[model samples]
Target: MSRASLASLPATPPVLAEFDELLKMRELLLAEPDEATASAVMRRFWDICCGTTDPERVGVLEAAPQYAVLRAFFSVRWGIHLRRLETLASREILADASATDLSAASMLALENYRGIDGELDLLGESPAHNAVVLGCGPFPETLIGLQHSALVGESLTGVDRNHEAVALADAMTRRLCAPRPTVTITHADAEGVDFPAFDLVVVANGLTGKTRLLDRIHRTAPPGVRVLVRNPTLLARMLYDHVDPGPRSGWRVTERRATTALSETLLLERGEHA
Candidate 1:
């Protein structure tokens, strides 16, 4: 991942020997497998995820070879860890206007949300707009900004695998988002949710196998439905490469737009190539 993406993580990283172990572990798992090392690494990972507010926990896995395993682990664990952190954040900080950003993660999230305003502006405004955001996360910044700023077509729905996160988003939206645009938050895993037809579908940050959701959008959304996938630049690939789509994947990058410093936002269309 880009060190920038790891901004919230610990200052110091692992030592060389431990780093070597991680790469070897990835190789072993790719070839023969290492339950003992895997178990220990996962334990340490969970410990770090729970103990700190670091978003991506940079160097947690230490190398690109373990990208697949780390991505899979994050896909399942983020909802749990982030929710735990958010619950604490809500109780301690979010109530204060000064802490609206909550943590580095939420700040980055809010920036990403704001960055999309231009693209949505280009798309123009419409009434009673139906939009869906996947991996909406613990905060509703993107949903709220998209709803009010770009005049995102009317109603916005945020989806996440974490039930608490969904509830938190709903509450936050009700508390903070502009009332002119209605929003709904749903609890559903990206892998299994009953994908709804939407005028716009956003595959937000922190979603694993990001291409999977893009492919799903193509399958469930109507023709011409606009899909925006947040991909990382080369610098951030260490953190997001696992979720990127391959060349054969039908979804094409129709247009590129500016987003947060951490991401490369791509405009994509469902069921057709642009």
Candidate 2:
């Protein structure tokens, strides 16, 4: 579906009201950020965008003049919350003996990764000998999950734009994996990375400019290499970026799997035609 057009048409009153209320809720959540309160607030936000039968709700909201400002506000706040939650959870996991005491958010992420892993298995793709995860945020949940499931056999490299996130993830990997760390965290933009070096590429939902990245991958990655892209679905479109890797320059969509209420995974493979 096409994104809602941001034309000269005035936004409906109801839509403006809904946007106002959402902003109020976001401000409240940002002020306090209590765990229970954050959960409730996020659920309400998701339901307003996703739960209703009116598919146009998301479009209407996005078409509004304030949409860009509101989206930035929501994205920044959500990113902060996720980083804080994951940082605490990562510390606990590293300290714990069994390394199983995961926060609810981390556990949910692992479940999503497992679902993606299953999708790969169904396609006979499995994990590649050398895999790279783009935008592997401060937590590096995707890398950790791959290690936990033994999906990756050789080595895993995590690329992130932020220097602080890269350092934190590097440190976490050393202690979290112990004697022999298979994961290497690096700071780099997706466009600057050498895609041809890796057989598998996993794109994080938080990464923007997805089409550009896909274009780079298609132009560089060798045939038979697999790519897993995490994208938002339904009204969750307001929260994350989504891509349709249709028959493109040299990429074909092998499978699409809905992993959770908010996210879906697209499996694409580099084809011979460029």
Candidate 3:
């Protein structure tokens, strides 16, 4: 629909043309109405966005009004894709107590968090204590990965607003994980979590109102408590929210590293003066 503007407007950039292609592919995905076809369409979209080397191209797209519509559409679809994987994984594991196999998507997600776990290792003694992951979804891969990597200390708690997700995550973790590092999944809002109770706090990528949550943590959590926030990078900006803790956000970046091709992890602590 917005493709007409690309031709009519004066000197439309290549990125705007790419945006038109993305919209067309989105419509194709809708017409197909199947996961395989949808996945193929999205892969093309991903390649187009990810292949762009210039930051200005992304900036151009972000400045366009179509960016909001495209982001809202793709973000929701991405969540749906993940929920599908999570649902499949949960069903299999729940059907058989001994089943441990997870979806490829789930495995890749675990791998991503494994990178974050290594970044946590850089935080010295911070991640060695109690840890909590906010907005852990149906799979809770981050929590499971941390426990498996031995990054968590006495306890690991996952908080999700969805009751169903909490139940599924709790069951999956209990069935799969060992008992040494106690794991608990609870239904709660990210903003209401007791940030001071844990030495390490992880903010999941999908968590909304991150500014408000970070503000709460900054105002409430102790100085030594470290916050690990997941942020999107490159083309991931289309599907995930970017967390920018500016100089005045009362938090300082301790470590920043890419956890995956599309995502990065940021370790933060209270600023020296804040």
Candidate 4:
């Protein structure tokens, strides 16, 4: 589809310049009398903007002409990739299918998490860490994969308000993972739930009270706990003015990793100090 909101974003001077170039490219594509040439240009643009293997490599694309345009274009592609992954993760969890048979969307989602884990590992952190997943959907196959990857430990607990989602997650745990790790699924709105102390917290697919819930989690969690979020709307908001919940909450804008075609993923870690 279209991500004009993301494509037309207003950011730093460099980012703005990039957007301007993308606009110029779009105009050229529209004005070109030959459709084939326009298509070729578009393809080249996508390759330059969206083909980075890792986050560090992401900046490399910016060195090309119209860097902002290419970066913005790729950012949109990354967002789309994340949405597809979320859908695949949900489907695989609900259906309990083998990973080999997973849809391309699901594969991308898995890759996105792997990328995040890789980045975290590069920071010299252990993968066998405790994590909490908020908004565990009717199918949390992605979370299951995370557990298997050692990105999460048996101490993992998932929270959700929907009974159906909780029941489904529990069922999947019983069927897929035996003597299951400390995977508990609670049916409670994220805003009111009593979150346990976790080394990492994951918030996926929920927008309501995200900041407020994060505030509570920050207050309750120990310093240095990592918070991973994959919400498109929330991430977009962060690009503009900061969302201040007060001194108790200090969040630094981190990286945005690609998940699928319709969604964007963000990695946020709470500050070490209160």
Best by TM-score: 3
| Model 2 lDDT at residue 57 | 67
lDDT of 2 by residue, 1-274 (tens): 1124322335548746877677678567758777888867875776676554355666766677767756766676666655665666566666666554234336644555456555455346365777899988777767776766566678889999888778767766765553332789988998787787787899988787898888888778776778888888765666667787665446787778877667778888777544
Ranking of candidates on lDDT, top first: 3, 2, 1, 4
Against the true structure, what is each candidate's TM-score?
Answer: 0.63, 0.78, 0.84, 0.52
Clashing pairs in 1: 1-238, 1-239, 2-236, 129-153, 129-154
**In model 3, where do residues sit more than 4 Å from their true spots?**
1-15, 29-32, 100-114, 125-127, 272-274
The TM-score of predicted model 3 comes to 0.84
lDDT of 3 by residue, 55-120 (tens): 777787788877776787888777667666665667566778557644433554556545755666
When 1 and 4 are scored with TM-score, the better candidate is 1
lDDT by residue (122-234, candidate 1, tens digit) is 45544325888888866766786776664554678899887777877887777667676678888888767545557787777667767666777767776667777777643
The CA lDDT at 215 in model 1 is 71
- Candidate 2 has its poorest 10 consecutive residues by lDDT at 1-10
Give the C-alpha miss distance for residue 254 in model 1, angstroms: 1.6
Model 2 vs. true fold: TM = 0.78
What count of clashes does model 1 give?
Answer: 5
Minimal lDDT window, size 10, model 1? 9-18
Candidate 2 Cα lDDT to native:
0.70
lDDT of 2 at 66: 65
